[model samples]
Target: MPFRAQPLRLVPVLAALLCTAPAAAQMDHAPARCTAPAGLPAPMASWRNPLALKAGADRKAAARAILTPGRTVTLALLPTPKVAYPVRPAKPGDSVSHGGLASFTVKEAGTWRVALGSGAWVDVISDGQAATSIAHGHGPDCTGIRKMVDYDLKPGRYTLQIAANGEDSLTLLVTRLP
Candidate 1:
């Protein structure tokens, strides 16, 4: 006779497992901004990310919290990014005024979102890749952040550039537990 699984005994186990994701894919629980200083680029054609810290959490204790809509976390986006910059400013949006940038540290590897809020275009640079970008005349927020793009980030900083077209007035809030 084949062994049968017990559903009743597996409810808690399933819940626990479902409650946590992998390290690299766990950024889904990290904060919005980094643990470094925040910044705002001068409206130009190109730009570089700043924040140079890791996810808001360290390994072992707690996982880094990912930025989710309606759940804001405190963090930073250093204008002095880890990568080299040609001094190229970011693509200013249409209505970005009183704007700036914010970064989030990586506690562990996990999926996360740098969802750009109200602006012409928000550019997200992770691990030196311009992965997620919100185009012009588009909404400020961008979801469906891909894996390896915003998750399982190395113990380092990630940049989220939120700006508008004319005068950057976009507000970036960094949210994280702890």
Candidate 2:
């Protein structure tokens, strides 16, 4: 009789555990959502409306899409093999991923920030050499920006290479830091 009562008492506990199992599993797999703050900083405000552009398969083709400073552009990329990067990406992109190139002219020498919405590799090239990145970080919360890389650049014609991106498109912004 005591054994029968013990099993009955455990019935409610077993039911509770079984019922909560699915909810716990769902919580573990749920994607995190970023809540927007009251406002974005000035540097990130232009990212709200990105200009659409197509990336070039090579440096010459990349001349068609010009990257403007302080403006955000969403680039449609090509397969990694199609892009002929002037300077190979320091960190090569996935062979199965996408990449492309675009041109930007730096009018003044300063620290320039390249912001992206994905974890793609960025290479700023000029005179057959790649500019070294000075700093790396993430964008402001809720802005949808995944990474930022800074480079010290002089006034010249440069190529902005986007590589190893998992998606077919990417959002990018090149801005000079004050």
Candidate 3:
């Protein structure tokens, strides 16, 4: 008689295979833990230690803090209604939101980046007009930055307006692209 296949004998073999499947799958698809980049870019590295300042309610108050390129500042914002943007934000926040104004002088004309730790509207204003934005994107993963906006700026004083932020404080950085 020909040898017959035995179902009972295969049960133990199937059970062993099933038990190891999950472990093998996990080894293949396990997510990697998030860690800072091996070496952070200059602008991103500045976020590690941020200077604290109060956001200005209006043009007058904005003079208190001078935003510098290549550095990060944490601004304490005010109620949206209290902020008087030199030029209206392209995306205006509701009254319940928070906002503020700060000023920065660009000694060199170039493409400058404005990075924010929250989803806030940023408008760079010079001579009472809004500078056109060149680019918009999210910051690097694992960094607290949520948004980044770029503008082509000329050497001069500009108003950095923060609007429509959900929180009363925001971390901001201005860095020039080489």
Candidate 4:
């Protein structure tokens, strides 16, 4: 008789494997713990769509909106070579393919809020570590979802890793919390 693989025994092994996967990374948001940074009328940065393409399919056009201070930038967030960083390799069951990069300098050493107009998954990467508190995926405007991440930041430069779940056009804005 040939030996057979037991289906029930595989359940536990599969469950354990999923535990180590990056699923949590997809929904990592901790806004409740966020406190407003100290400073009245903190600096505000705005970027409008510079490409004027009104679409997120063009990689070069989308990259133009990479978060510059006191300026309006525009760009689509698609998976293309023009993206700021190399497209991350996809894993099984992963659907996100669009991403963009932006950098900002914090002048105050307090809690700050990074808000995005459309609902896109955002990662506040600093010192090579991802932020644990991100408040996003809400609102009732275009696309019906907005992303906001409040973070405690010091005086330094930081990068914002943003990605889109679909081929949607939108704008991104960054500002200091009250």
* Candidate 3 lDDT over residue span 1-178, tens digit each: 3346577778899999999999999998754457654445775688868999889988888877688888899989999988888888877799899999998999998999999999999998888899899999988766777899999999998888999999999999999888
lDDT of 4 by residue, 1-178 (tens): 3345577778899998899666675556433332443222223333323333232223344344345543434435555343443233232113445566656677777766655555566655567566566444343223212555677777886666666435444455556666
Residue-wise lDDT of candidate 2 within 33-85, one digit each (tens)? 76664355676678879999999999889888799999999999998988888
Candidate 1 off by > 4 Å:
1-90, 94-98, 126-129, 132-154, 165-178
Rank candidates by lDDT, best first.
2, 3, 4, 1
In model 3, the clashing pairs are none
Model 1 — TM-score against the truth? 0.32
RMSD (Å) per prediction: 18.4, 5.6, 6.6, 12.4
- Sorted on TM-score, best first, the list reads 2, 3, 4, 1
Stretches > 4 Å off in candidate 2: 1-33
Clash totals in order: 66, 0, 0, 11
The digit string of per-residue lDDT tens for model 1 on 82-143 reads 21321223754222232234445656544443333343234454655654422222211122
Q: How much is the lDDT of residue 25 in candidate 4?
A: 59
Better of 3 and 4 by lDDT: 3
lDDT of 4 at 47: 33
Better of 3 and 4 by TM-score: 3
Total clashes, candidate 2? 0
Each prediction's Cα lDDT score? 0.36, 0.89, 0.87, 0.51
Estimate TM-scores for all models.
0.32, 0.79, 0.78, 0.49
How far in Å is the alpha carbon of 34 misplaced in model 2? 2.1
